[model samples]
Target: MAFSGGFGVTAAQGATNPNNDFQVANPPNDGISSLSWSPTANFLVSTSWDCEVYCYDVQANGQAVPKASIKHDKPALCSAWMHDGSAVFSGGCDNMVKKWDLATNTPTQIAAHDLPIRHLAWIPEVGLLVTGSWDKTLKYWDARQPTPTLQVQLPERCYALSCTHPLLVVGCAERHLQIFNLSNPQTPYRSIQSPLKYQTRCVATFPDKSGYLIGSIEGRVAVNHVEDSLASKNFTFKCHREQADIYAVNSISFHPRHGTFVTTGSDGVFNFWDKDSKQRLKQMQKCNAPIPCGAFNRDGSIFAYAVSYDWSKGGQDPMASAQGGNNIFLHATEETEVKPRPPANRVGGRR
Candidate 1:
């Protein structure tokens, strides 16, 4: 192998502290709102409150940069991809959902919703898609049809949800985590429930050889037996916070190996924690605005995040000066007053 270069410091005699830190590229002064990673590739997708969605290629050491992009008519909130990576799905404040075909580089006509879409997930073993929205409803759809296959009503603000075998887990802005049984596709029965506020960042379901887990926005990570419906209220741990006040937890991704997990927080950090012991392992400091979502790469060696700009003061308020730009930074580059590296390799060295 060729000696590429060296910027990282050494930890011990042979241990290397590789430069795997984050740098804001395309830093939208508006700040990022949400992020997602491709299920089978080295690509990342992030959304900005400025009405833009960005796709990036993850570099060898895990840095990210813009690869392709789509400037939308509305700010996208939730994004996901099909199991085979043929298409991308997004739901947003515009009260619409869309399917972007990677092969055609075109989006199908927007699928309208009754309210702002807060979260979306592709059901693992089926061809259905589910979205939770401000409309206080969860709509399930068939990619082949323009209309939803089914819709479930909610009593309050619905923010996020997850799916496992025969179950659909949902959360609301009013702090409700409701579990639904999907054994009968025509009728989803509520199986469990949990409490949370607008502070819950995200929710997820994980599967392994014979076990599964569920994580919440309160920085709680829980694991249980695969078919154990007994894990309804078993979470009991918090993420590592250095100097940030974790107001909201937006997303959670369980590692593919070693059972590690990561979360994005309103406190502005991507926290990595061990699986069973629930101990803090590392931190990827980037979250600024309350992050709306996050996830890890398929292999778990890499990760991605999506953030919505902070509008807590109000929607009409002026954007922050330092973060007013509408770009999503992927990895740190030497493109600064300190010692910016002139633009060098692009396209992950592929093209």
Candidate 2:
């Protein structure tokens, strides 16, 4: 609570208006590229294209503020929290990876990539940190060691990465998909062309770690199973899009316990899906702008999403700036906006 001592203004940042269903945080000056909740606390950390990162306290019915902030020389593209929440790891367009210590509020350069580091995956079980860069390489880092333990070259630059413990899934340019077991970093367990033709925007694995979901800029999502027996169950669907206009699937997240997951897109919508059933669970009120990212708390009881202009410029609209497109929303998992509807025939009889 030391960071929250002085900056708890009720509604000063971004749009101050608040409501019952959604609570908007004091957003960054630019689009939010990534968001991650601390595994041990009711806190959230986000990276922005404004070359800064913001931390928020998300307690029950609490207002979010800029509890702590850090600025980089260039846009911070991605971030992850250490298992214990003692520190955070951030990667940026500056081609640097920094580890920010929470207690001391200091940052240390841990690794450097040849190009902008777009994605990162931290495996707590093995104490291994994997960084994927636009330079088309995945570098494995052990904080105790000065140099990377292993590096694997790829056919194309990395676009998205997801981890389920020992499994590391990487989605790269040129419609390539690779899955590696962190225990064996030399070769991928599975390597194949992405089911979707468009570039990947985001990726997330299932709660059970059986497979993963990869979303594309063309408003499509594909399910890839890790086991061959389940491969027949894999499928793809078109989502977060409008008639004639295509929007990027900016984020994908899975609920901690349920088989359900959430998808956010440049189309200004957040769609909840039951992956096993392949059905739209519910759609929340539109944000009126592109949504760059979404995240679920460790227990999956709360869901947070960033409604900002997609910095990618894939849409037909002009680029979003600080003046607009920086709203962060937090909603409960059981909120009426996302609850499944009762069967029409079971409702009050109107015969």
Candidate 3:
């Protein structure tokens, strides 16, 4: 790959470019662990197993120019942007969480966990950074402080986490899911088992905040409601599988505006779904590499995904890396692809 200037890289198209989609310039040398879009801008941040966090400024013409990057002592597992898009917070196997100021490109350690942090979310309304770790605990921190404001124990290692204002959901190993009403952030609002039979892989809150979605290693997703009265509405559906071949559902991202969402999987496919109608909205052609993570931009105009080795088979596959699987792709969202279908045109209920 050719370098642009300073720390940035110029855009380069991929060999199997799909229509309306373009590959981002330079990507992490190893597997991508997570992707996050700034809440107030088109800027995107990605954390990877390569121990680096990268920021890119995606221009309107579909070109992603690298803006900045920072390195951790170990693989960075997850990243989340500050509310104003001025900085980013990341955590990983290093057992440390660091805040990177975009202006100066400086990083400062803010918190630490007993074990590797698996996921993190920034709760803007609460002005706290919440991190879930393999230590079987969830800790909340105010970046300005030296220690966590609060820490809650989990039943098992945290595998996935997602937050939306008053709601925070954590999916742990052993199919344990704990929901927190952030208004009462000290304790869980509810603790329950995930509907999916296998290990929980990822979780995402609905844009409306009425409920959340859980994806599992068995290629199934569960739609659940926060209220017991709406419990009947909860259901599970299958995806990221063909016949007997099943792959883990790696990531789920919701459209900031449309309330629709997408799920990317280890099978190298991503699908858009509308929970209101229990129907599939769109399914992109499968990639040659696993899509470990993805996210939609602030206004839901752009969808960015990482096409790379996910290490789903336990250890690294050198062959996949040798074929240059580390890359990012940007898909310009079309109205019909993400917009909600009319009630009349909707059909089906769970898979």
Candidate 4:
């Protein structure tokens, strides 16, 4: 491995690398935009800018043949699985949220996003789905209703959102981060003011902390300890490759059962860190394309990735180039050495 900053252990996986240790494909063209896994089932769900939902069976040698495909005419932005994995919930540029039954190729269209759908999160206990959109609003759906179950107005276009236990969080393009107490579901009992240094791209929290992590557009990250309305940013780090432009944060996921977290940046660098210490651990930096999303399940057993290149790289085709760079990572109990085989580029290289 090439050494640049510090002595870091080397791990490489990419467009043609599935990290499956089981199967690899020159991942197909989709410009994968979102991804998720059934909390209680052996399946994975993902969405692309093409308005299609791709599901994969979670087994060794598992082939990600499309489980159900929704061609909505407009682009789909993000998705999440139902509590029981029976259905898939998705939101998109169509300004609406739709639920698809995995058992059958059925779509149940619900509330409209009013603007481009940026992200969606599912709260199982309440049987509700939460969405953030460019329309400058955050809406919640009962899934049981034909319309948004509830709505909250933000100051700017909503960029990302997440719901963990007692709190429902939202990020704004203006960099404001809001926290709501979902125990009441209807109204956010509290809200926090974000620090002035960066424009936040996303926010995350583990199962064990009152604090949260924020990914910013300014190539930095911060940790905030918020309990009720009182909050403080305990630490912040310069977290991206040095460049003349802002480093956009793509996606973040907590280590299911450990004190760790991972993030994908616009610079095509994936970072692993000590969730509690705020220390950067390992980084996968080979991708020339920007990765938009990544996820890890509760046990360190399964993982998923979706890559999209920097639009300014070359072509203007929104769906071309890195659109097909999808990858799956699994930590097998048995040994797995992921070597970068540059043979005829079997996993499928750039078209």
What's the count of clashing pairs in each model shown?
25, 0, 0, 5
Backbone steric clashes in candidate 3, count: 0
lDDT scores in order: 0.57, 0.79, 0.87, 0.64
Would you list the clashing residue pairs of candidate 3?
none
Tens digit of lDDT per residue, candidate 3, span 265-290? Answer: 98888888888867888888877778
What TM-score fits each model? 0.74, 0.88, 0.93, 0.80
TM-score-better candidate, 2 vs 4: 2
Residues 143-231 of candidate 4 have per-residue lDDT tens digits of 77877878888778887787787777787876777777787766655555566366777788655647677777766666666664534
Q: Which residue ranges in model 1 land beyond 4 Å of their true spot?
A: 1-24, 27-29, 59-65, 185-188, 191-199, 208-233, 240-246, 283-292, 306-309, 312-319, 322-351
For candidate 2, lDDT tens digit of each residue in 1-351?
222122233444333222233555567887788999999987899999999988887765546656788888899999999999988999989998888888999988888898999999778998978899999999989976778988999879999999987777899998898988767878998898888888888888776888899899888888878998998878888887677888888989887766578898887788887766556777666655777888988877777788777755755556443225576777667644344444332111111
Best TM-score among the predictions, by candidate number: 3
Q: Measure candidate 4: CA RMSD.
A: 9.0
For residue 254, give model 2's deviation from the true position in Å.
0.5
What is the per-residue lDDT of model 1 for residues 33-79, given as tens digits with 9 covering 90 to 100? 66676777867777666676667766665445666666667777777
Evaluation by lDDT, superior candidate among 2 and 4 = 2
**Which scores greater on TM-score, model 3 or model 4?**
3
Clashing pairs in 2: none
Off by over 4 Å in 2: 1-22, 314-316, 319-323, 335-351
Stretches off by above 4 angstroms in model 3 are 1-16, 316-323, 343-351
